[model samples]
Target: MRLSVLGAGAIGPAAAALAASRGHEAVLWSPSGRGTMGLDGRIAAEGALSGVFPLRVAQGLEEALASADAVLLAVPAYAFPALLPRIAQAMPAGLPLLIAPAASLAPLAFEALRAGLGPRAPVGALATTPLTARRLAPDRVRIPAIRAAVDVAAVPAAATPEIATLATALFGHACPAAPDVLQPALANANPIIHAALALTNATRIERGEAWPQYELMTEATCRLMSALEAERAALAAALGYVVPTLAEALHRASGVPQGRLAAMGAAIAASGRAVLGPAEMETRYVTEDVPYGLSFYLWLAAGRGVAMPRTAATVAVLEVLWGRDLRANPLLEALDAAGLPRLLREGIGR
Candidate 1:
């Protein structure tokens, strides 16, 4: 398979490298072009994925999508609005496009945009990224771990099995079909975990202290995360989706023992795979997750008449702390909550 991976950040390069390792041809493109600048058509990866692999760096979006069997958007959630149009314009029809670590109902947004462009292939999203990695350099990546399984869903819902098959083949892991796009949307745990970590450790971030994210998951911090998770679960239940609990998710992602949230955090911290926490307040931990992630959850909760005081309060406090309205998610803003449930399950015009 030939894969076109967008974004040059940690996940993009790592994914491209992983594809190459699996004997699939991969071409990588960075929207800004800077992410692939220093790489001379080869990627160096360590940890779970090791050694150097041959990689092609496309100079433009058109070049990247040309003759590709599949397209993976590895960019951040905030980049979706701007990049989706360009992607929809250039991508060849009938080519599968996937959003890794999909957030804020991005696949639906892309589906809506693609609807006006005429017939195209299925658009899908992963509940979360298949691997946890960090960019060691322009061409180097460190993959701490690869997930055992990933939740996948497609806009039309009927195309889920096909998309999941493609994902499994590409990543060499289990890709399970979700009930609907909303299931994957609600399955993302970053917002719930990051919100508690960022807010509780604001001082550490502001002071530029290097803190290990899981190590600092004190009892209070874990308690806050549990509270947020409860609210999120309630919202998911209201939508008739029973997503995994926080502990269950952590255990699956990191191979930590499934126990209390704090106990899981402790196990992850003791494991060497723990990544460092954000060093600055403006990090995506708050900016992206708050607006694109938590805000979307709140919007859905409101439509379902579900109470999310903890979730709402966290957003409110973060806004005050950052002096910015983090809930102004353009995707959510453009959506009508009353119609979203059905919209997420069925494609546009259904």
Candidate 2:
């Protein structure tokens, strides 16, 4: 299969290498073009799979989009709005476009793509990122773990089985089908883990303490994360899905032992895949996950009259600490149950 990997982050290089190892062709592209530099059309990979993979870097986004059997957007959630449009304009009709680690990103992309491409275009989301990797260099990545199974959902929901089959074939693993986009979005584990880590260790991040994030997690931090997870689970339950808690999610994805939150954190630390924590509060934990993940959860809770005091409190504190309003995505604010399913199935109807 010829796949186009959009974005040049750790996941992109690692995924490209994995594809090549499976005898599939992959072309990587960076939206900013800066990420493509230092890539001499090859990948030096270590960790889960070690090798020097011969990779092909696309000269431009259009070039990459035009020459692919499928597309994978392995970028940050914030980049979705800007790049999805360009992708819609150039993507071949009927091509499958996947958003890795969907986490509420699928709806936005689905709406954006269908506005121009219509309802038949295959746009879906992965429940979580396919792999955990660290970039050693521009063209080198260290992949510590590949997820055991990734839940996937498509816009029409009927297309899920087909997309799941395709994903399984492409990744050489199980790709389960999610009931809806929201199921995968709420099931995301990053916001729950990242929020607790960043807030509890704000002082450490400020001091530039380079510690393993998962290894050093305290009982207090775990307790707080559990509180947030409870609220998230409540929201998911209200929405009709029995979502897994943070600890369960960790165990399922990385083989972290399930017990108390602290025990899970310790296991994650010893997993050899644990990476260093953020140096400051300005990192994605507070910025991206808070807004896209936790904040979105709070917003949903509020409408349902569900009490999410702990989740709300964390966001409030982070807002003052970061000196920015956390719940500020206009698109999300505009969403409600009455129009949500329609928007998910059809385009924005513009």
Candidate 3:
């Protein structure tokens, strides 16, 4: 299949390389238009899948998306609102649009704007990104690992089988069906993890102190993450799904010893994985994860009347630090819990 991969950051280039390795035509585009397009349309990748692969880097979004059988969005959560509308406009009807690591509320927000795009524009949200990757250089990327399994939630749930097949084929991971977008969205581990990490390390981040992120996850931070996890589990229960906590998720992903969630986090931190910390306070751990992630969790909790004091406190701290009301997300507020299941299964007004 010809795949149009958007956002030429860590995951995008790695995904393009993976597609090329699988004998699929993968064209890449950078919405920011700042990255170095590969020399002669080629990118060198290492780590998990190592090789110099041939890829077509498009000059414009339309050029990248045109005639593609599938579209994969690899941008951050904050970029979805602006980018998805442009993609919906340029993409031909019926093309499969997959959001890698579909952060909470992204699919709903996208579906809201994607009205009238027709049945062909089926959107699937993956619970997490396919690869743990980084840009090694302007023309190179390093992928450390692929997740053990992927949960995909498709709007109009009927598309789950096709999307699962395609996603598994493309990434060589077990792709399972999620009940609806809420299942996968709540299953996301980043917001809880990032919320804890960012809040605990706020002072260090402000001072530009650098350390391994996971290593800095102290007992206090892990306790906070566990509290948020409990709140998330309650929210998931209210929504009629069982979501795993961050520690269980880590154990499943990397075989971290399972006991206390904090110990699990400590195990992950001491695993010598070379994961780095945010050098500045204005990092995505607080920015993207706070507003688009934790705040959205609070929004859902409010609708369900589930108290998430820890989660709310975390986002509130971020709001004070960032000088913006992180909890005031209109898109999330516009989406009500009563209408969510139908909205996930169908579209906004359907």
Candidate 4:
């Protein structure tokens, strides 16, 4: 398929490279005025896959999206509302559009698109990004040695089969069927982890420590993460979505030990790799995951009258640090469903 990869950042370039390697024509697009991504097309350094092939890089969103069979927005959550409507206008109505690793809230994005394009345009949201890619340098994206697995579903539920088929065709085995968007959304693990790591280590992070961030993982952090994950699972279960615990997903991603949640966490600590990035809390895992991701979940928990103390506390701390009421951030409030309170407790797609 002719694919236009919007955002040319860490995840976007990695995916474009994969598609290009598979012989598809993939174009990389970056929005204007953000300063161009590096010569390697958004990556900061060179990697094993760096400069391995020729890629078409475009700085304008519309020009790049104009004629692709599919377009994937792999930018951070913060960048979406700023750019998606422009993309929707440039894209053909029938072409499948995807938002990979859409952080926490899938429904909000669908609602945003609906508000902009009135549901005439079709789009898909991946439960998470297809690859766990990192920007190792100015001209490189270090795709994890282990191939990542992605779960995808389309809005309105009925759109899943065709989207899945097309997604699998471009992405091969990396794209798998998620139970539902809610199932995948509930499965997302970044919000708690990022909020925990960033809040707990903000001082060290602000100090610009080049030290391995992974080594900071502690029993307390992991325990808190588990608690947060459980709270989300409770909300999802009540709403008819059963997602695995954070440790379970971590186990699957990194071969967690003894196949237990605690052991899986132990494996993460033992690995001692900075699972979160060293310096920036910027993209899919952080920025996107928080407001749209964590904040949305918090709202649901509150609306459902479920206790999400850790999530609530995390949001409070992060908002204070960031100096914003994240609950009403554009990304968080983009869709503003008239009956979202109802949808959260009893999902529409499910």
Q: Which stretches of candidate 2 lie over 4 Å from their true place?
A: 330-336, 345-350
Estimate, for each residue in 1-350, the C-alpha lDDT of model 4 and write its tens digit: 78988876677777777777667888887675332356543333233244464567776766687678888888776777777667645666566778776555544454455444444444576776666677665456676423345566666556767778777777664556664565666666767776777777766666666544445556776677777787888888877677756665565456544354445555655764335544654433345567777787876666566888878888888777756666754654644445654444333333
Model 3, span 181-234: residue lDDT tens: 778888878888887887777787888886777666778878888888888898
Error of 1 at 135 (Å): 0.6
Q: Superposing every Cα of model 1 onto the true structure, what RMSD results? A: 1.4
For each candidate in the order shown, give its overall lDDT on alpha carbons.
Answer: 0.86, 0.78, 0.78, 0.64
How many angstroms is residue 343 displaced in model 4 relative to the true structure, after the best TM-score fit? 8.2
Give the root-mean-square deviation of each candidate in angstroms: 1.4, 2.0, 2.1, 3.9
**Candidate order (TM-score):** 1, 2, 3, 4
For candidate 1, report its TM-score: 0.97
List of clashing residue pairs for candidate 4: 43-138, 44-137, 44-138, 44-139, 45-137, 45-138, 45-139, 45-140, 104-293
Worst 10 residues of 3 by lDDT: 327-336
Which model scores highest in lDDT?
1
Q: What's the TM-score of every candidate structure?
A: 0.97, 0.94, 0.92, 0.83
| lDDT (Cα, tens digit) per residue for candidate 2, span 122-173 | 5677877777788888888998877777778876666778778777777765
What is the lDDT for 339 in model 2?
68
Task: State how far residue 268 of model 1 sits from its true place (Å).
Answer: 1.7
TM-score of 3: 0.92
**Candidate 1 lDDT by residue in tens digits, 1-350:** 99999999899999888888999999999999899989898999998889999999999999999899999999888888888888878877789898987798888887777676566688888998878889989889999888888889997888899999999889886887888788888898888899889999988998999999988888999999999998988888888888878887787778877898877877887887888999998788999889988888888877568999989999999988878889877766556667776777677743
Ten consecutive residues with minimal summed lDDT in candidate 2? 329-338
